[model samples]
Target chain A: MALLEIKNLHVGVEDEDIKILNGVDLTLDTGDLHAIMGPNGSGKSTLAAVLAGREEYEVLDGEILYDGEDLLELEPEERAEAGVFLAFQYPVELPGVSMTNFLKEAVNSVREARGQDELGSADFLQYMRERADMMGLNADLTKRSVNEGFSGGEKKRNEIFQLAMLEPKLAILDETDSGLDIDALKNVADGVNKLRSEDRGFLIITHYQRILDYIVPDHVHVMLDGKIVRTGDKDLALELEEHGYDWVREEAAAAA
Target chain B: MSTTALDTSVRPEDRFISAFEVNHGEALNGTNASISKQRTDAIERFAELGIPTNNLEAWKYTDISSVIDRPYTLPLAPERPSLDTDDIAPFLIDDLDAHRVVLINGRVDEVLSDIGDLPDGVVVSSLAQAGSTHPDVVEEHYGKYADFEDEALTALNTAFVQDGAFVYVPSGTVVEKPIFFLHLTATEQDLLLQPRHLFVAEDGAIARIVEAQHSLSDAQTFTNTVSESFVGEKANLEHYLIQDQGPSASQVHTRAAQQKDDSVYTTISATFTGEVVRNNVTIEADGSFCESNFYGLVVGKDDMHVDNHTFMGHVQPDCSSNELYKHVLNDESTGVFNGKVFVSRGSQRIDAYQQNDTLVLTKDAEIYTKPELEIYADDVVCSHGATTGQIDEESLFYLRSRGLSKRRARILMLQAFAQEVIDEIQLDSLEEHVAERVRTRFSSYFA
Candidate 1:
């Protein structure tokens, strides 16, 4: 059985028929790391947004199934509680909310849903400190407001830091390597890699092949013109990086 | 002061005039000759001023014309009303090791008060008792800092002032614990409570004062409270006022202070819930090297009106002042903030900063803010700013994305915005107590 299965997914901007995702079909199995590579505006990020249930995206047709249950029936928060995480391309900044407070609430919210007790301050602090250490973040960032005045790399790192603390079963990385330098990308990839397990699945979306060198995925899917034109092993990513996106575009156009 | 009698065409004004005439003789029984003269002068001035309306620039946002529309018998008597202290116990700071002064309907309640041992020369008593005991001190400071002639509410308080807490700290003495004033209103019918409080910190003295206002009944209440603080040379004073207007409450508060050379004063006013509430605070820096810090937060919903007016006068050179006022409005709640900083001539190197920030939770909620700065000194740095906005959509989405319900996310963000100001409270227990109150207040919004 698949961890996540998307059949005939057709999505577009709300209140308009301008489609972004046209009958896209995909599936992710347990213990599989899938990478979606595409050029700008290739509907890569739109897939991530639709999967996260953003209000601006209207899912006109299709069904999203997670672990054999209809995922589209859940709210964004419910999706999050059901172990779907989208590592935002650009993490939002909350001016007055401290990182520790946000992480505590997030962890407690998920924990309570799973019939687990809320973490006490002492235990929570220890839990957070251990996770934060994996991302090379200090307890200091936990004290500061969440990503407020943080550098570009620091913002991405904070997202991965949240990813580490949440430990979601199916994580979605939407351009998580967009603005990161080599060191920061390695930091984020290392943080995500540390959380990978046999029971977990990940969907890594990127426009560049730079991040694939670190957290190599088992399956690589090429998206072009609102559709996945090709699918193969990790070698397809290297092939696309070497050959560029012309062949994928030609193939998608010819098929259309 | 204008002595011309105001046309008592306004029904509430007429009632007030009749009440003043009826209570004049008995109310002046214990006051000294000087205070008696001040009282008579204040009442006469109030008769001329009547109730201030938005026509006056200072009262533009808040119109007290409707505040006195209903007939309310004034709580002018000195008798303590009966109340269940247990029911009102939640308003008190549980472990606060401070001197407690309780007032029931504008009259001091000595039975419920706890005035622990104090250092010599540090006297805490009722305003009337203080006047009787320290005539010169009372004569020198009472009704002086308060601009009763111009403010009808202050004048009204001065006219029929009976009993409020009074604290006097002699030179070089430091009161270890805060002097807490727990003012409770316990009238079921429509009533008005006017309390007059005075604090005098002598040269090099230090004092901490905390005031909380609560009500016992669900009846309509109008409270007009006036408090004046006189900080002598190099003295320090800290004051905090929290209004928990219980069940159809309306309140008007005037807090004024005078700071001498090198003296410092910090004051905070927070309005948690009320039907109609307004606070006016004025600080006069009379000598060089003085410092003043002012902070305020007002939160309300459902046809509630909360207004705050603050003025900082830099009458001395080399002084610094900072002020921050924030309002969070939800569900048809309206808020108003008017702040002014005046740096007079020859007050060089005066640094003043004023900021007003408002957050509107719903589309129906509204907020109006005015930050005014008048700098006549060439070497002064004076700045004022005002910001009005709704909660950031991105921030809300971020919180909601992490498994928090929309309601929980909103409450958390609102708490964060309010806690920033509460964090400025220097007192430890007081800070925690205020944070808890703030959290509970936000909780009631969802409730």
Candidate 2:
């Protein structure tokens, strides 16, 4: 069985009958970096959101199996503890809650969920400084509010920094490169690359092909209308980059 | 302490009957006639309005029945006791010279205080002395700015008014040092202390005052206080009321400021004690181009209840007011915030904003908040909002994920919530003092 498997997944927002992720199927084995490239409104972010167990989205018909455990049965925080991390496209700004405190809570909660002893304050601060340095984040930013007044690039880097701190088994990058400049994009991709291990998987969701050049995925999947229609190697991403998403639409139509 | 036994012959209409009827016909030997008349008028008002019950809209959440259950006789003028200045030394902000006006058991204690330097044309003395020396100033502004007719606490304060602080800054004169009114209620027996403060800042003048209500003993006590301030045109006043009494004490405090045109008034209330404490502040902009800022921080633990009610009225145009209050409730504590802003007719171009935010740490802790905005003028901007919620779980998880324990994460979150209000305080020393007190109050939970 795959390390991460979604069989006939269906999901929608609560209080709405309209489905967002309909009959979606995907499988990812350990050591695989899969890029889900699609146009806007193609359910790229919704898949990331559903897999992270966002409270607003309801999983109506799917079963998500993460390393032989039912992923859908956990709460959002629980899903986070089970090594499922989603880098939000638009990070929420929490004023007054400092970045240091936010990351400390997240790391210790994940540790406790995994039945590990929590780290001491001095050790946590040292660890944060090292991880933040890897992502080119300022140590002072950790003393300020979480994402409050932070530039867009800073927020994205903070997310990657969190990914490095949490060390999840599966990391879902949801539009992680959207608001970043070239340098910020390089820093984020570098952080992700460093975190890549033999036992970890990655789902890189994005709309553009520019980020792929840096993060170089093992497989590329074209998502259209809430379903993955095409699966190919890295060359497919370059091909799609040369010819826009319209070519994928044409191929999907031809297959139909 | 049975509820039924506490309910007696005192009818709702005659709650203050016995207390008002027993009058020390002869004025206390040393008190002046002006103070006597002011006390008499306050007693009459108290008899007329009586103590407020839950039926009153603003007092709905706070039940003062337990306070009124026993008939509290006004304490006689007892011999003043000496205080160890070291106990209060920590609260004194360093480097700033302050005139310390000490009041013990409703009377001035001149022995334990230091009367600091005063600028030219500024008078800092006890209220009883003001009544004799500056009767015109005392009779004109004393109790006139406060709404004694509607506030029972104001009336009660007037009924028992004995000694407090009287500060008057002349026109264009600036007093560099703050005038500190230290109300120390010390007693092993039940005591009722009523203190009054009257501050008048002349046009173009500036003054800062700090009124601290505290109890050195842990016995049961009741402290009722009323402080009225009048700010003239172009004057600037910074006033702070800090309550640090023991947990067994109860207090009812009313502080009001009337501002003239082109004047600025700022009031900060820090409440960290008392078993049941209610603080009400009213600010009326009676002139144009007046600006007022009201800020309060209440930290409660165990079974304490802290209720704060504030009113800001813009009776003239070209005025602005901003109010922000924050409360941190832990254990089974309760908090109530009632803030109202009224822009009366003809008060065009008024700007008013009021916000109340509370953090409930435990399931049993509760907060009831009501913020209202009444604007009669069409060309005005007035908005009010109140919110009560637990700390954000995502924010909490985000903090815990950084490797800090859940307890420390919670303390940081609560401190952050409080810092939003604390950061707005302009006085650095007072802000640090309040922040330290908040940390100390929550230190047990974290430990």
Error of 2 at A125 (Å): 9.4
* Weakest lDDT window of 10 consecutive positions for candidate 2 chain B: B1-10
DockQ values of all predictions: 0.63, 0.22
Docking quality tier of candidate 1?
A: medium
The TM-score obtained by model 2 is: 0.80
Tens-digit per-residue lDDT, A41-156, candidate 1 = 98999999888878888988999999899998988888888888888988887876878888899999988887889999999999999988877875677889888898888988
TM-score per candidate, in order? 0.92, 0.80
Q: Tell me the lDDT of model 2 at B261.
A: 97
- Tens-place lDDT digits, model 1, residues B1-447: 101123346676666776777667675455765567777788888889988988999988887779767666665556556766685687788678889888888777878888989999888988888878988888889888988868988987888777788999999999989999998888666777788889999999998999998878888888888999999999999999888876488988899999999999999878877788989999999999999999998886788899898899999899999999988898988899999999898999999999888889789988988888888889988888888897776677778778888778888889888877887787888888888887887887765
lDDT of 1 at B443: 82
Interface Cα RMSD in Å, per prediction = 1.2, 4.4
Evaluated on CA atoms against the true complex, candidate 1 attains a DockQ of 0.63
